[model samples]
Target: MSNHKDEVEFPKMSFLLMAVTTGFVGGILWSLIGYLCYYFNYSTIEPNILLEPFTVGTWRESWIGIILTIILYGIISIGVALVYYILLKKLNTMWVGIGYGFVLFLVVFLILNPIFPSMKPFLQNDINTLIAAACVYILYGLFIGYSISYEHNEIKYFKEKELKR
Candidate 1:
């Protein structure tokens, strides 16, 4: 029997592009969920919370600020995707995604947010907002994790099909 690595076979460019596009989609989904929660008063958390430093009086004055926040979050999401991709070889992607989302919640909410004085009040809110934010992150995590799994399978199948030809 030959030992072959269950490899993630794809061009680096394809992987990078996929990660970025997935991140973009995740960001859009996150923003939509955030706004919905805001509308319902389920949570006061906003997508632009970390962007407080970059904006002046309001986010409306500078569209660039909004765009920048999205882009930044997208980049961060790539890190989440990377973790999923790395662990996909060994474990279930869905569970890994959940763990990834939880870790992200801990890192951002518990660790990073407290570092910024501007974010203090937002983080200090009651438990309901935390639950809402956790839900949002878990959903985003599931998207990235499943997406990577699906994309990887597509690429692998194409390669196998080509070999058969």
Candidate 2:
């Protein structure tokens, strides 16, 4: 019984640590994927594909761009984590995580991409960008859903055991 009670506490510090770590890792991985596509001349942006084509000479430039992009993505990832946490707090289910992920992608596609001139080119007659966005969002959703569900389950299990006592 005491063990169950202890479990129910679910070390806040640890959960937070895990969430941050997962978010960072997920962000980095997705960024790397995007970078690779860009580096290999597989990017949707015609200017990027032609002007400063991805090559050893442009490696440094690409690195700088990718890193900056990744940082931006990391910020988005943090927001995603926060949203997931909030949804879990309110709904107590992982389904909201999935919806949140889709919403994030939709906003990027419909609002951000269109409004941002730089992003306009990527979406213009480019299937790759769409595919990339889909892939990233799917992975992002999976990561969020898994992380949130895992945490929620752990807490719920602990609470149940505590009640049994």
Candidate whose TM-score is highest: 1
Q: What is the lDDT of candidate 2?
A: 0.61
Write down the lDDT that model 1 would get. 0.71
1-165, model 2: which lDDT tens digit per residue?
367556554436566666666677766676677666665656554222222322435543565665655775666677667666655634545466566667777776676554444456434647766776666666677677677668767877888999999
lDDT of 1 by residue, 85-140 (tens): 77762343687767777777777787778655555554477777888888888888
Off by over 4 Å in 1: 1-13, 60-68, 86-92, 120-123
TM-scores of the candidates in the order shown: 0.73, 0.66
The C-alpha RMSD in Å for every predicted model, in order, reads 7.0, 6.1
Candidate 1 lDDT at 8 equals 60
The 0-to-1 C-alpha lDDT of every candidate, in the order given, reads 0.71, 0.61
